[model samples]
Target: MWRSLWRSIDRFSPQYFKYILNELRGIKVVERSNRELVIDILQSMVEIVTYGDKHDPIIFEYFMEYQVMAEFVRVLKISKNSRIEAPLLQYLSIMIQNIESDHAIYYCFSNGYINSIITHPFKFEGGDLASYYMSFLRAVSSKLNRDTLCLLVKVELVS
Candidate 1:
């Protein structure tokens, strides 16, 4: 359904991004079968945001306004297995790397959202989860600049 709509339109609209975000947030239960659906939606959102960052700022703005990253964190926390968590981290890496605006980078790193994901307890005994985690860190590091570095790391004042 979403693939058809995406191909039908020349460019994805903000409304479509909103609808996908709603679907992302509407996941009440995460069964084995539905994990694929969630991954698909996340993949679609990654594409949407990537396209938006290049072509349409409004789409990306809507994505940011809808707090999609926070939703991703929610899904990550609920999904205990590595199968689901791995792709979420991969898509998150892509999104973070594609984000060009400083404000968006700040939003991504703020609220301990990324921090929470960073601190998430994933069972990485032997799988690609560890690799994906490293890639996600690389993506975040790729975006680091003088302005955005402070958001990811805290430099507290000792009184």
Candidate 2:
């Protein structure tokens, strides 16, 4: 079953990648408050990355190639509730923390990707969401440098 699924995908195909991302974004718009449905979709995303070899890097590579991380951020930006945002944040944290390529990491900071997420976690007042947000920040800071950290502080984006 996995072989068949992988076979049908063109590893370099932008269409397949975009189709999955569009479907994810569509779920937010169409199903709005369906938390179970949202979690299900998020779970499927995690499953995709976990279903293959333990060291398999195909999914993350695809994500960077298509710049799908931006799409994920877009979803998180518009997310209105913890129910939906929590899983997305968890997924984002994984994506942000394990970024293995310099180019991908560069794009993250260069494209204002870090800014979007760095500020997201503070928007909510709930503890469940804040903890994940804090974790995400911790993951990001581990990779942050002096200049980037200074810039963030200079802009008053972080305390």
* Tens digits of per-residue lDDT for model 1, 100-140: 87667787888778888899988898877899999999998
Give the residue spans of candidate 1 off by over 4 A: 1-11
With a 3 Å backbone cut-off (N, CA, C), the pairs that clash in candidate 1 are none
Clashes of each: 0, 0
lDDT of 2 at 5: 72
Each model's lDDT: 0.83, 0.60
Which lDDT tens digits does candidate 2 get at residues 1-159? 778776766532445445665677675442356766666656555545432213545655665566655766666665565456767778767755766555445555656676776776555664587888777778777767864554344464465
Q: What is the lDDT of residue 9 in candidate 1?
A: 49
lDDT of 2 at 74: 69
What TM-score quantifies how close candidate 2 is to the native fold?
0.62
